[model samples]
Target: MIFLFRIGFLEVSWVDIIDIALVSVLLYQVYKLIRGSIAVNIFLGILALYLVYLIVRAAQMELLATILGQFMGVGVLAMIILFQPEIRKFLLVIGRGTEFRENLFKSIAQWRNSYHEDVNVNEIMEAVKTLKATRTGALIVFSRDVELKFYVETGDVLDATVSKRLLLSIFNKNSPLHDGAVIIYKGKIKAARCVLPVSENDHLPPHFGLRHRSAIGMSENTATLVMVVSEETGRVILARNGIYLRGLKLKQIEQKIVEYLQNTEPANWEEISEEEPTTTEN
Candidate 1:
């Protein structure tokens, strides 16, 4: 390798610069993934332990160094266990980036037209508008390429057609099924009162409640579009691929759903509407 420069005893080269750049990018991505969660604290704790281990070993403290060395030896497995969700999310990101996955998703979109029917977007929009007006909280999950049977099994099977009336009734504050989420697939309500995994993202605004967190978690884990209506503020929030758009108008929400179903990218927030600014709490 050709050396570019020398810093005292250390030689810097093009390969070294490239290696450092790649490692920096990787660390940045990992930090972004776990930034707002409990995983960050755990990550820091592990880093601290490693630092201590290095110090002890350098000082020739044999007893402490040996114990720390053993811990370090098992750190890889321990990290896998402790950060399972983060690891899964990381792998999912990598998988999504592959050309094969993109082609597969495109194929799935085509298959929907021949095999699976789409849900009534108008009915869903109407129900969401009503829920927002009435300050009735609701979580609705729309399945995409992935089959969410595992999550569906967690709730009551509905097998009912999608309708504004049915959605309103299901999410009525007094209704028993109002507490959990409703899963929609193939133009039908496949399940109701489904328990979704709540996100541990600490970066989520403190104002966001359990409903929003659950929506984020479900979206992160699956290729689904999740809608959440805040019970407290009557704000309509839409989540896709773990990205949450808060205070969206009914028209904006409809357009997003339509675009997503049509296998096209949704309009950016700025393009959605300038008159109605999207507000993200926190």
Candidate 2:
């Protein structure tokens, strides 16, 4: 191997440079995927501990090295458990990217945007408008690509047609099924009062509550759109890709929903981001 440069007594080679560059790129991509979540801090803590372990080993502190070494031995499994959601999302993105061109046409359901005519989205917006006007808290999930059967099973299954009256009644303050989320898939209300995973983002605004956290969490774990209507303020907010879009009018929200169903990535959200800083679970 040829040394390209020297840092004191240490030699640097092109091969080493290439290896470092690739690792850095990988780390950057991982950071991008997990940055807004609490996983970033956990990842940093693990990295710091590993660096300390290396230093302890170099210093010949066998007692400390042995302790950290034991942890390092099972680090891979620990990371897999801790970062299960993030890992799944990363891999999903990679897999989708690789096969996107090949599967673009054959997968009819993936083109769920086509369901626009069938989904009766008008009823949802009307229901949300009423909910907002009444200051009633509501959590609604729209999933076109995936059935979200697991979360759907968490609540009472209605499997009824999409309609404003049904949505309004289900989310009514006194309704038994108003406590959790309502999942709409394939133009039907599959379930009501469904529980969703809560997010672990600690930097959320003080005003955000459990509903907002759940919305963020569900988006983090699945390719779904979550709409949260604030009980306190009657504010309408949307969650997708673990990012929140706040203060959107019904028209904008409808547009975004259509875009999301079409499998389009959010291009610009800076305006709403300025309105609220963005959830928490342990």
Candidate 3:
């Protein structure tokens, strides 16, 4: 290797600098993905062990290096098993932001999108208000860019118009469809009684029930804004991209939903949410 400079007997090259930069970038990306979750501790432990392995190998400690080397051999598979959720999220974020996806979306846009009128945000707010008033637990997912067909197929398809009465009826406690979620896409009620993935986040407050967990989980895995009406406290919660704003005023929630449907949310939403505490209605 071409040496740039030396410290005692060690030399560093441009190639080594470039390699370290790339590895640092990759590790930083991984850290960003799992920063607030439980997996962060596991990731740090693994990183510390790997650093020790490198140190041992560099010092020519044969026995310790050999043992650590064995662990490194299976590191790829171990990381896959341990960080499955984070890996999936990383891949999904990549897929969503890729030029291929953008081009694909443009091409697909040419084939569909004939609907002219927009879904009334006020109507949804009204439905949510009624649900809250009745203390009926409900989960509603709204998507503007990506149609959540995968999760939609998990329950009954409605393809009905968005209305206050319809939402109220579907979420009526005695109604058979009340047990699951409702998905609204492109100004229409795309589906009802949809099943959503439940979040395993340990940091979530215990007061959050299954409905809240499912809403958070759904938002975490997809490009969707989820609203939850608590059956216990009759409070409203909004989740998007893994961050939540719980117990906000109905008007505030309505405004956020409107922004979401308009695809006008501020960039790096999770970052903003992390820096600001949730505001509750007085």
Number of the candidate with higher lDDT, 1 or 3 = 1
Best-to-worst TM-score order: 3, 2, 1
User: Distance from true position, residue 11, model 2, in Å?
Assistant: 42
Error of 1 at 217 (Å): 1.6
TM-score of candidate 1 against the unseen true structure = 0.60
Q: What digit string (tens of lDDT, one per residue) describes model 1 on residues 1-282?
A: 899999999999999999997676667556645654567768899999999999999999999999999999999999999999889767766676663355445444563464557879999988887888889999999875444655788999999999999999999988999999999887889999999988767889888889999998877656678889999989878877667886576788888777766556645532464355454422
Q: What ranges in model 2 sit over 4 Å off?
A: 1-75, 83-117, 269-282
Which pairs of residues have clashing backbones in candidate 2? 201-279
Better structure of 1 and 2 per lDDT: 1
Task: Tell me, by lDDT, which candidate is best.
Answer: 1
Prediction 1 global C-alpha lDDT: 0.80
Instruction: Estimate TM-scores for all models.
Output: 0.60, 0.61, 0.62
TM-score between model 3 and native: 0.62
Q: Candidate 2 at residue 44, lDDT?
A: 92
Badly placed stretches (over 4 Å) of model 1 are 1-115, 267-276, 279-282
> lDDT per model, in order?
0.80, 0.79, 0.79
Tens-digit per-residue lDDT, 9-53, candidate 3 = 878899989999767656655565565455766778999999999
